[model samples]
Target: MSLPMTCRRSSPRLLSLCLAIAGALAAQSAIAADSSAATETSDDAAHPPASDTRHAEHAEKSKRAVDLDTVVVTASPLRTTAGDLGKPAAVLAGERLDEDRASSLGETVSSIPGVQSSNFGPGVGRPIIRGLDGPRVSVLSDGLSTEDVSTVSQDHSPAIEPFLADQIEVLKGPSTLLYGSGAIGGVVNVVDGRIPEEAIENGFGGRAEARFFGGDQDGTTDMARIDGGTDRFALHADAVYRNAKDYDTPDGVQANSFIDTKSGAVGGSLLGDWGFVGLSASRFEDGYGNPGEPGDLSAGERGVHLQLRQNRYDLKGGLKDLWGEGNGLRFSFGHTDYDHIEFEGDEPGTTFTKNANEGRVEATFGNRDAWQGAVGVQGTDSTFAAVGEESFVPQTTTRGYGAFGIARRSWGDFQLDFGARVDKVKSEPDAMASRDFTPLSLSLSGGWKLGENWRLTANLDHAERAPVEEELFANGPHIATLAYEVGDPNLDKEAANQLELGLQYKSSLVDAKVSAYYNRFKDFIYLVDTGDQWYWDEENDYLPIRQWSQSNAIFRGFEGEATFHLADNDSGRWDLRAFGDTVRATLADGGGNVPRIPPSRLGAQLRWENGDWRASLGATRVNRQDKVATNETPTAGYTMIDAHAARHFDTGNVGWELFVDGTNLTNQVGRVHTSFLKDDVELPGRSFDVGVRVFF
Candidate 1:
């Protein structure tokens, strides 16, 4: 008799080795409990209280400087500051987010440490954290899943609007207990006010921004947001539209690289001292082309266009001090309908649709004795289908339920946190056998404040994930990836054991943080090329044959960042910053190195701020990636320089900013190894954008 693929056990040697390193580090310095690299949420600073007219008037009199410590809601069910969490976390908002905004969420935050973008093109991209992408990483809107088919392929985009977001949070390591199975890699949560949590002040406020970008290609973008309310009622609305033409490469024009996207949302809420209730409706539409290789055209297939659409309805409510002496309740529900069509010239090729609904309720208990945390239950149901040619996976329906809790306690100069979750999942394929799985996840972490200037933090987590529908039923060609895929129905669950250690230093002159992590997996599910090719029709067009398989794997990485305040005087402030990140992944069973791993990168920046003007000059260098799998090739790296300058003006009721941004200033031809289209498309060269934004 043979054993199953999944098993539960501990690696004593690896555990002991990591524990020794952590112990040594703990002896030298106490680690900070929170990361110091995040910026504060700008909404509280941008909008004043409506009840205090005096404060509102004073706020308009003098603008406040942005804060570096911002509150984040994704770390736990209860909102906590980014610096209070035990993981390496980052926040993007206000001026920083706007300056880095792009057509895809992945590119918008690619500069963050330990994060990389899997750019399919300007039309589709997704985040890769550490050395993990695809099904391991989870992308969320606010706190719920986007419920899109993006995870099925690299060419599909997440059905969410990034331009309307007020803030974006990135968690760099295992955050499984809070979000659930797929978050073993990390979480990217996009926060917006589509459903108003609080009433807007001053009765009315809004902003409108427009931008024009040109390089080898040209693009235009327009966005608008508005919020207004009485003391107890609020209304919010936002919209964004973008259009771009085919981009140019060092060789010539990359064919069929155009994009068109539009999104809008409307929301209303009732607010009071006891909390608030709100509801919202949103719609998103995207039409884009897939830029294939110049000579990779098939009979009757001149061009490929994808038409994607989504409609979502959300309801949220909360009650403070309701259940117990110091308890509160918060509940949220969302329903999403999504569909996409692949069009080959004037003919329809394939149509995909997904319908999903999710609901969650949580209760937070205040500090009693020494423990404080929240408990919650979440339920989700989804149906996915594909019709016409290239329908790889059969129609499938998934139902899931989970219960989770997290608690924290403080003792002397040390803080300890613990969390646990259990989930039940069922996947039913119309033409295949039904599969059921139960996964359990847990986490433990501690932070020791080593005096006033330094701190040390350590965390351990165990996460388990069940196979998704595509991994269990796919049995056809996926032209988007240029591969024929086969799935294994008897595949078992995946489990990961990870450990992380971090150190932080904060003072008047310098702010620095460094972290290292190791993860070991059991029954890791991955797609492996079978070294066989399948021909498409009678044309002899062929693709590699790949099969979903299970193996043991390990990934390890380190990342660090530091900022030094060079000068702070009445004239202005000057700062110097440096950051670097790298990761190595391999199969423990000696299969080979993992494919498409991002190359190591190092960057430095010199920045200056004086009154209404801000300027920065920076350079980044990516090292060549020589680590290759059996079926993959090596990729060369390159260096890039970028610059930006902006000026702010106050015009009575409106404040506006004029900015000019330059990328690839040196005009270096670079290829991103993480991109599926790296061989067919070249990264944009020497681009410049001049834009203006007005807020009133």
Candidate 2:
């Protein structure tokens, strides 16, 4: 309960993270008092088969501890497994999520751990959890809701497509009971199974990839995918293309940063054993540039450039064990048609539009000894417009509805979960004002299993939100976050309360987890800076004036991860890892700080594998963000190094991989105080990437 002496300052790395979280809470309280005296002896249940033969020889060590056989359906509406989803989660899959696919999904999940990345460049990025990001972060695709407007700002860009992800979870804190209220600062599901619910293995399969990148913005990418079936029918397809040019910055190249993108998709499904149905269509196109302006003017100079597009359509369905054994049902629907245009250096300076529709339905029932859960209904409709001359938020329409539920239960090693939700939001603006809100939410979580390698978890939440449309109708100049915006239509409705705690460890050679969180807000809708100023002419003169405000806030954080197995036979294996994270937002009455937060980090990595070679190396440090807010400006912390290598090939029927990657590699000059173009972008210098991939 401190901070606010101009956001104080000090650190020996936060005193070594408070002596490593007080030596991991005193070694988890001496291993929970030696597992409660070995479950009161008698060889613990007279050796219930020695814990079922150590769970059948570690059942793949509990899916390699924490990777618990990846099966998350966004924090539960019952797809469970991620250690039963009691919050704090992360998953980005295979080939390290395809070599960290990046076309900005906030630089492809920004290396997990409490995540970060608001770096609006390299074609707009977003994701900023822990300090929250626009519309409180909920970006799904494959679980619906991606009616993009990119939370209405931050240079947009979030039309889903992290190289056609096949996995990308990340459901940190406060997930409004199952994705509503924009997940209240969490949820980033992006699984991309197209539309096949199941079946399509060996009936046919496909994938392809190509990549290239070299320093100062050189780039190229290509992708392809396919699937097939006939157990009643199934099919899917995908495509992508990309180009880049303005990157590089050890002080150079970033001018009008360039990019051009493309996307495609197709789908079909109709199988059935119990049920399945599907449909799909997709398209996206991009043409970027808007390095927040700099250098050489002409062509009617003025700044801002964009050309985006979207066209989507989808329908989904599923059912299984109909009204009995694990009864189930699932549904989804989507439709979108979005548009963007903003060139200013060459006419057409405004034009935004969207036409969206969404739907959802869920059902599932008691899956056993105690209970399992799911229940749902969701809806949305949108129509937005912004016409010429920097139109700033009007001509709009929005609607939403929600109903949710979640449940879970377990005995022995204990486990519990709960959820609830309600929502109704409306906003109409064609002619200026109209608003409505009805938010409600709740959640609970728990877990325990303090032996067999430790575990403990807890979560509590209460959420509510409704205010978007740029916080209720933004009003002017937005030179890409240079600010001069305003919005407030009597803003209200935003309540939050959260708490979390976690600890986990699994053995077969060591693996770990640790977490901490706290949040409390009530009306906390920020964006301030009213030093008043707005004249945007005569060579970009007046700018400040940020508006959109509210008060009472608080945020707290901690994150952790660890891994080690430094050596495992058969000619290959060696690993080591470490991670860290931190957050501290304020203004719960003592107004100070709480702006672009995100500082404090620590990292390490080392690896080497065999069976088709692999390699890795890493380093990270970042930690110099002087709290700030009050004419904010304080950032200076750095240390980065990266490396990678890969190789694999089978060619029996198709399989291959080749890679190389490196970044920053000693050429620093980084800046990303959670970026608003951190004083004119810089972050990406000394780069290299080379790739290839294929599978069948």
Candidate 1 residue 347 C-alpha distance from true site, Å: 1.6
Model 2 clashing-pair count: 1
TM-score of each: 0.90, 0.33
The candidate maximizing lDDT is 1
**Residue pair clashes in candidate 1:** 30-455, 30-456, 31-455, 31-456, 32-455, 32-456, 34-83, 40-70
Candidate 1 structure quality by residue, lDDT tens digits, 1-696: 111111112234323323332342332122112212212222211122221222222234233233334545444565666777776788776666777788888888788889988877788878899978877888888788889999988889898877877777888787778777878888998877777766554455566566677886688677777666655777888888888888876677777788899999999888776777899999999988888533234554558889999999999887767755456788889999999998877678889999999998888876645778899998999999988777888999999899999998888778898999999989999978999999899999999999998889999999999899889999999878888999999999899999999998888898898999999999988888899999898457998999998899999999988989899788678888899999998998678987889999999988888777788899999889989777787788888898888877655444567788888888888888987678777777788877766564
Residue lDDT tens for model 2, 1-696: 222121133234333333333343344344434432221111110111112222222223112222433445443556665655678878776656776788888888888888887877788888888879878888888777788787877887888779987668878877866778878988888877778665554355556566778875588777776665555776888877788777878988777778789888898888766667889898988888878764355553645679899999999877776777657778888999998898877677788888989998888887657887878888998988888766778878889889888888899898898888898989998777699998899988898998889889988899988888877888988767877789998999888998889988878798888899889889889888978888888555888889989998989889897888878778677788889899898987689888889897898878777777778888888889998888889989988888888776554434456788888788988888977888878877888887666554
Against the true structure, candidate 2 reaches a TM-score of: 0.33
lDDT of each: 0.78, 0.76
How many clashing pairs per prediction, in order? 8, 1
Model 1, global lDDT: 0.78
